[model samples]
Target: MIKGLFETHINVSNYEKSSSFYEKLLNIIPLYEDRVRKSKFYWVGKPGESMLGIRENYPSPLVQRQHFAFRVDVEDIIHANDYLKALGIESTNFYGDSPEELMVFPFMPAVSIYFDDPDGHSIELIAMLNDEPRTELEIMSWKDWNQLHTK
Candidate 1:
């Protein structure tokens, strides 16, 4: 049985840039910042809970584009979207079908919005806030971005 995910680490070329971007996106302060190896780690949740790290290490000084996602409350999804927009960051619709898009295979209890970091690594922010019992398929079903886009 899987216990839970502790944190995710992604390699990048620019440490400062990536660190700033993630800090803005996650809206959480970093737990630690190591200067010896040019690496910056941040806490995704409350202190002592869990954390994510962004290490500066590109293949050839180029941007490292990988794929990753984070889980959020369903009610907070809109706020997240707004936050991103306010920062001038644009996220691609998942699946690309109509206004609704599919980000990835059936992740349960949430929906994902596709995006990328400075290095072009694919990133996703998943929102989970449904009161009703949900199946992986149901929660992962195609979502109408148009509906969410409207006021």
Candidate 2:
């Protein structure tokens, strides 16, 4: 069974800068980094399951509009946003229409703060609230979907 998300990877233009940015934002040392491949991989959230990977690519091409979302501790959200703002990092507000749902950027179910790494790759710092109903996530696997939908 697919237990959980193992990692999320993004191609970057400057490996060192991107690595530093994530390290600073996440407040954890990278589990592994490879200078030879111009890539850096790290683990956050979980000891073995969650990993973040970044690679170097010059003349940064605009990647397709895609984003990876992670549910984070609510307290971390405030600290992360303040840290980003202090460093002059730009982020978009997810919650707009609804005051209760408003976040740093326009999104759904959760309050998300969107920013970029040094390579201009988008990153999101999301505050996963308990109030976000389970129905908000559309499950893919029939087993998981059926289990939750039935509940």
Candidate 3:
């Protein structure tokens, strides 16, 4: 039977630089490293949660960037935007514009903001705004989501 996500591997040009970036971003240290394999990765969150593996990209560089997301509290979504800004990293919307415009997935009733990692990987922080069950996919603005919930 299928359980849940155990780990996800990401390719980076430099191990030290990528590791440092992830350390600050996730606020966790690598649980394991294989020096012989030239790979170092981190196990983030709590036990049985998920692992983020940062492997060195040797020989060939990434031809294109990848996008991935992390789920956080709605308030943390806002806080993360400010946090990235404080670190001089600019946050953006799905269009890669100002993050002040929060994107909403009404199907999941989630809000999200986006930014890039040191290796140019698009990272997203998403927060579910409602506990109400949804059966259909819906897309709307965060403003609409707030108003709907407040009303």
In order, the Cα lDDT scores of the candidates are 0.65, 0.60, 0.75
In model 3, what lDDT does residue 76 have? 85
Higher-scoring candidate on lDDT, 1 or 2: 1
Candidates 1 and 2 compared: the better one by TM-score is 1
Q: What is the lDDT of residue 9 in candidate 2?
A: 79
**Any runs in candidate 2 off by more than 4 Å, and if so which?**
58-66, 95-101, 104-108, 132-151
CA RMSD of all predictions: 5.0, 8.0, 2.3
User: After superposition, which runs of candidate 1 have C-alpha atoms over 4 Å from their true positions?
Assistant: 58-64, 96-109, 129-151
Stretches > 4 Å off in candidate 3: 133-138
* Candidate 1 lDDT over residue span 1-151, tens digit each: 9677777777887889888888887646677889877788877757655677877773355555678777676655556556677877777656643223443233343566776788888877776544333343432443432243243
lDDT of 2 at 108: 34
Against the true structure, whose TM-score is highest? 3
- Candidate 2 residue 32 Cα shift, in angstroms, is 1.5
Worst 10 residues of 2 by lDDT: 98-107
In order of TM-score, best first, we have: 3, 1, 2
Model 2 accuracy (lDDT, Cα): 0.60
The residue pairs that clash in candidate 2, if any, are: 92-104, 92-105, 93-104, 93-105, 93-106, 94-104, 94-105, 94-106, 95-102, 95-103
lDDT of 3 by residue, 51-111 (tens): 7887777536662587877767887886777898877778887677678878787676678
